[model samples]
Target: MTHAETAGAPAGDVATEQASHGKSSLPLLTLGAIGVVYGDIGTSPIYAFREAMAVRPGVAATETEVLGLLSLIVWALALTVAFKYVFFVTRADNNGEGGTLSLMALARKTFDKPPVWITALGVAGAAMFYGDAMITPAISVLSAVEGLELVAPNMSRWVVPITLVIILGVFFVQRFGTGKVGVVFGPITAVWFLVMGSIGLYHIVQNPFVLWALNPYHGIEFLATHANIAFVVMGAVFLAVTGAEALYVDLGHFGRKPIVLAWFGLVFPCLLLNYFGQGAFVLNVGPENVVSPFFEMHPDWALGPFVALATMATIIASQAVISGVFSLTQQAIALNLLPRMIVQHTSQDQRGQIYMPQINTIIMIMVLIMVVSFGSSTAISSAYGIAVSGIMVVTLALLLVVMRRNWKWPLGGVIAFGLLYLVIDGGFFAVNSAKIVQGGWVPVAVALFVSLLMVSWMTGRNRLAEKTRRDEVPLEFLVENLAKKKPTVVPGTAIFLTSDVEGAPTALLHSLKHYKVLHEQNVILTVRTSTSPRVPDDEKVTIDAYNNLFFRVVVTFGFMEEPNIPKALALARKLGWKFDIMSTSFFLSRRSLKLGQKSGPIRFWQDRLFIRLARNASDATEYFHIPTGRVVEIGTQLII
Candidate 1:
């Protein structure tokens, strides 16, 4: 069934059921919500203070600089978090979901303008996020583990091993799934926040002056007095906003209210206190103590407890990113921006809980390499801010488009907010760009590889599908033959794969040409994968019963998803279509593109490489779950 067919289906229909329930859950939905959604922002304290301090050139950890940086952090939280995300972007959610892609969906729906630029920018942002995701685990865990050296200097050697073990254990637990471990996430994260706030209060009592940093003028004065230092300070301030994107991404899971409450009520206060605490620690103990201000706040006897808490927090942070990777990949699959891969749902009730073996393994390899390559938190920090800042810039750009198209905000208001955001985010991007030569190349390299693969698969799929459409059998010819010749009847339904919206598909033409007959019921199915993850199952399969003879069902998946045609056919059975797997004849057109002619940015070598790769890609039979013997492949030539 096509989307057009399912358009009017009621809420009670199987495909539309999920869409109807989109608004049902109002409370914080799961235990993982706190840890998954808030962990990244919570862990920002580990490196944010250190990076901010590094920004001041030779300036001692004076009360003034500490206050200045703290003021900037407060304002960043207000503008980027409070005003932009909470008040503005949160309302742009597509059916109560948020992300770059979700925002893109809203933009495309509201504006008919060419969205290629929007999508391109979104992809770049998503690609850069991979870098952030990889380094986040490394830095968060490494920074916490390095606290061992603070308690006993000789324990420095144990940092890498301890961090690696924690990281490996965190990822390994993903297979057991979030359902079990998720129960402890919220309480553990809540405790982590309490610990962060308590430590900050301890230092704040010693130096009440740190509270003055809450003022905006101090930040302005610090920047005015030290312009060069201010420019560098962005590299550090970028860390504070590292997980800002999550606020938008996870909006769909817990809804805007719970997330905002989590942030403004719990997360924000704790983060501010911790940052202030770190400032106090620096002012009282000096810069050398900056390495582990977090642990230093604890009593000598409580160092062990602090380390354990920090370790748990770091693991939770990494778990959040691992799950994020799955979500992003799923989005990519649905959007058709990536090749289909195996996607297994971890839990029946939790639609968001998914596990992709390919993505998991790939991330595991990249993360392990990151740990080995940049052994220390400080070293890994160099590669970190660039990706985060770059992505923020992209998000800002998208937000401008959303404000204009969705909210219909006045041009003046849009420009005012957009320019202000651009200045702040763009400055940070420039500061981070300076690190391109200083280890930032790692993410750039990874983004380049992933982007290439994404672009290749997308273009290749488009070209092949277009070629298949151009060479397909005409529907008029089928109609003509049906009237003139006796219609030979075949048993059951014959499902023919098609890439075109009009006329008889090539598979149908080939079937009729070879067998000289059409099945009693013909299903001209076209699987349309969108550019977002998880098409509302309520609109999953659309069926058009044309005179009870021609049936067309279009099944949609996200770019990071695999299509199961047999499963879809089985779903059709529930809708009153009698489809027998053994009796159903599945026809697939296998297009063979000749090496002679091809267009677009794809070179001949790359085309050849893509064809080779696509051929070996999970077989159509396996991917679609069709009976091997019943499925027939028809080869068609393409001069691409």
Candidate 2:
């Protein structure tokens, strides 16, 4: 099925089911959710518990401390992942799509015209998400591969190289599409979760006292007593819910029902079991003897199989991140924050599966660099908290704006929700404050770099738009002048693609100036990308025909949908638009940008950056899917 067909499907699995199995596919969809949606958080059991325990400063191993830390981790998942994201943040989705950009688009739709701050917040959040994306695969895969150390301590040196090889293979297979392999993702993850729960259960039964951590007071008392250590430990404790955003971000693919069922039915129980089981082991055996508690939990004979299973689970987790960045890149292109890049549909059977070569290459290089630099999962754990914490805080901040302004909640109600998450998020963010020089700087630096790119792109576009608007003549004036001048009428159709449909296109003006003739049927075609995710086919086009043998056609596309001019024009048949591909000539303005002499809303240096970006942007003809044979490129220069 194409993206257009699945656009209305309830879930990714449902889409596949409707294509193959008709309507009887709820169980399959829920299982599918297990594989894709919960991959990241599911794999956390391998490292999160160990990392949190290791972060305690100057504290001896004790049952009270173990229980306390476990309590904190459990509550963090409940409040942050379950309550904050699934409960509230997911509810703020824009037309069934959820993510930083989708939320930003939704916020933009909430007002007559939103302020600049909304755009800034969205960029910040998105940049942070990219930073988090880099860290997730590095930490998740390494953490899983690091299990080799428990089975064969001598093979510790090979862990990094082995992980790099696995990741490299994953990236290599991306172009071939994951449709065949993706079928088993749900089953593997489901089994992984079951194993995690069983192991934790066996250990938890050995010491039921671990259940005491589930009580709120032990966690409160632990924090109250060990304030100093508790602060630092919160950073590691955050690892438990690091990829919680996946739950919300992948909601559109899985839908609310299957994702919710997968979560409440299996993912949550298994995670709690593994966490509490680790806590129990620490309480009974003491932290000193617990050499990688996660792997060591199973029988000695199960070690090899456990490692193999873990490696697969982590790969699935990393796949989620890779797929997410592709979607985010697509959104950025649609929103005009980033220049257009080639987006290829990876799976003809799956609508959401897309691959961008440039983005895939960038992520591959960065992820390898991260793995080589960090060496071990334990070393990279500190950096993980920073990226996840930064994203979470930004998400919560945006959620507050949505509740108060968009939802029109009472002031008291908004503040209550704000304070609820703020206390939890503030502590996690604050812990990473001390680790800036020790790898925490990586993601923060990345977020800043990405945010800089976005801001420069937007700033340049705005100022350049203003500069062009000043020089543009109204379409009415141009039409009246053309009528008086009596330019020769040509036989073929002319389609001038313009950003501003009401103004005369530079290409159209140039065509008239140089060729000295107007086409029999002229169209000022403007493609407008809306803030929504998908627009209905029936309402996709609007046409305005003036009396000067001229036409103004506006094609609307959702931010999630790709623009195809030929396809869109086919729908304009009712408006007397014949759209003969052989006879239609698409005119596009190719502007070579130069830096402005002085600083304006954006800096001179920034303008240079913008020019660089504009020059590298995808060709208008290619991006709009226009036939190359019918495209006429008119060149010009613009200084801004």
Candidate 3:
């Protein structure tokens, strides 16, 4: 679970950026929100309604079954996106950050001793998101390109190659960043939504009675009577709200007011109009001839341009999913749930416009595999909803924990909210689970593999920390011993970094044992990552004197704050230390980890994984933004 930044806590870069974004102009942010936040759900009409009706082929869909599916889709949009995300989940932000991990951070803080199971839920949710990330680009692009069949039936043979080319192009441009093309996103997405509404309205007017599906009775009646068929159909219907969780994850970028306004004013109405329009078309004309109601709505003259526009829209949707995965990876690194990857800040002005090459490449590779394997959107669609449902079910379960423990709502209120959301989320999950033997196994296996790594990393870190803490000697004891046997004092300042604030740093002790010398002014620096988002500059550092040559410094940062040791040292002038970067040496420990024969809590294989993870983690000099020329690394071997 993620934690918030606290006063005097160690922090990183995301908090300050989120703070600035939280204060952006409402109308401008609202425009940007439509492109990024609504991309996933906006593209749903492309395959959602078509998939639902096509789930049970051979048997023609009766008008009642069609209305039932329509009712199900419409209500799912309202409850999942409009109510669950924009209304409830968005309010649980930790200083303008929201996600399964972010909410997991908030939910765990209510009690002194956090429930261990809560952390598992957060990790699993993150894993499921990664699974969704892998499939979204493949399926979205494939569905868009499939529109080619309408323009030219023989051109269908080239769909896979065309989709691959487009996927590669999207991943190839990640290094250049999205700022150059982001301006056009808002305009194009806006146009796409308007067209969706217009096409949907054109058909809806032809079958004016189709509006009856908007009433809850149609959905309730369908579910109450058609239990068996409804149960199976829920899997396909679940796709209608697949990107609902993304709204909360990206909530910090545009702020709540703008996102809410964009949803209520534009995204919501347009989506409903288009969904109802697709249903109207299906009901007016029998469902047998309609492979995709979405493409079928357009006349022959508009087919080519519509396919081109769709390809553009789906690409934007894929871009948003890719960007969201990068953001999640950042949060996971800060929370120490994953190893530090090379994070590239793309835009000079907006930190939110950052990218990760490692993750982007990984996702792109996975997308290509999926496109090659499935060969078409219909086959790929079978693998889609399971991951999304898994994530949603887990998020809602965590929300129940947040509502009761953090919100301080009464038990009755909590139970009502939990049951309501859970039933909706749980029902979807159960139905989707039935697809496991079918193509659904792909995402489930992916999520499980990721969860294995995440859980093992956290477990291994705790074990290593405990073993290291036992070997730590108090700073006061080291100082007193040094006074009795004072070594030759060096001319420059020495800063030793350690997680154990109370003890002498292992690097510092090693430096004295080998070199037999001490710096004129020594500082034991303990950099902390706090539970909040941003820490005040004044509260960033605390200095305490041990003796003439020995000093202890504690630097705390918020989870969203950047952990820049050099910047913090420059600000150390207040504590009577001469801040000269040229004369200072930074001491850091490089632990060479190996698996132990004797095991305690973790499995034998887990220790090996952790050792491998620690071995390959990003260097402290680079991660903390410390100078390389003045840095000293002390090697320590640990088996855990």
- CA displacement after TM-score superposition, residue 212 of candidate 2 (Å): 0.8
Model 3, 1-640: lDDT tens digits are 1122343322222453455575667678888889988988888899888888876546677767777888999999998889888888877776677788877777766657668888888899999999999999999999999999989999889999999999999999988899888888888888899999999899989997778888878888878877767776788888889888878888767777778999998999999999989988887887877888999888899989989998998899999999989888877777778877777788988757878888998899999999999999888888888899988888888888878876778999989988898888888889888888878899999899889888888887777777887888888888999999999997989989887766678898899889999999998887776555556788778888888898888787666556778898777897677779899999988888877777755588888887777767777788788889999999999876
RMSD of 3: 2.9
Please write out the lDDT profile of model 1 over residues 1-640, one tens digit for every residue.
1111111111122222245246555344433456778888888887777777876777467778889988888888777777877777776665566777666655665544545887787678778878788788888888888888877899988888877787778777777678778768788998999889988988999998999998899999888987876766867787787877888787656666667777777788888888888888889888865556667767799888888888888888888888888888777655655665667778877667888787888787778888888998878878888887887788788888878876789999999998888888888789888788868898888877777776776677776766655766566566556756747887787888765767687767777778888788788788775534345565567787654567777776543334667766667766777778877778887766676654545477667766765765555666667779998888766676
lDDT of each: 0.74, 0.82, 0.83
Task: Show where candidate 3 strays beyond 4 Å.
Answer: 1-19, 57-59, 574-576, 599-602
Question: How much RMSD separates candidate 2 from the native structure?
Answer: 3.6
What is candidate 2's CA lDDT for residue 494? 94
Q: How close is candidate 1 to the true structure, as a TM-score?
A: 0.90
Scored by lDDT, model 3 comes in at: 0.83
Q: Which consecutive 10 residues in model 3 have the weakest lDDT in total?
A: 1-10
Q: Please state every model's RMSD to the true fold in angstroms.
A: 3.7, 3.6, 2.9
What's the CA error at residue 63 for candidate 2, in Å? 1.3
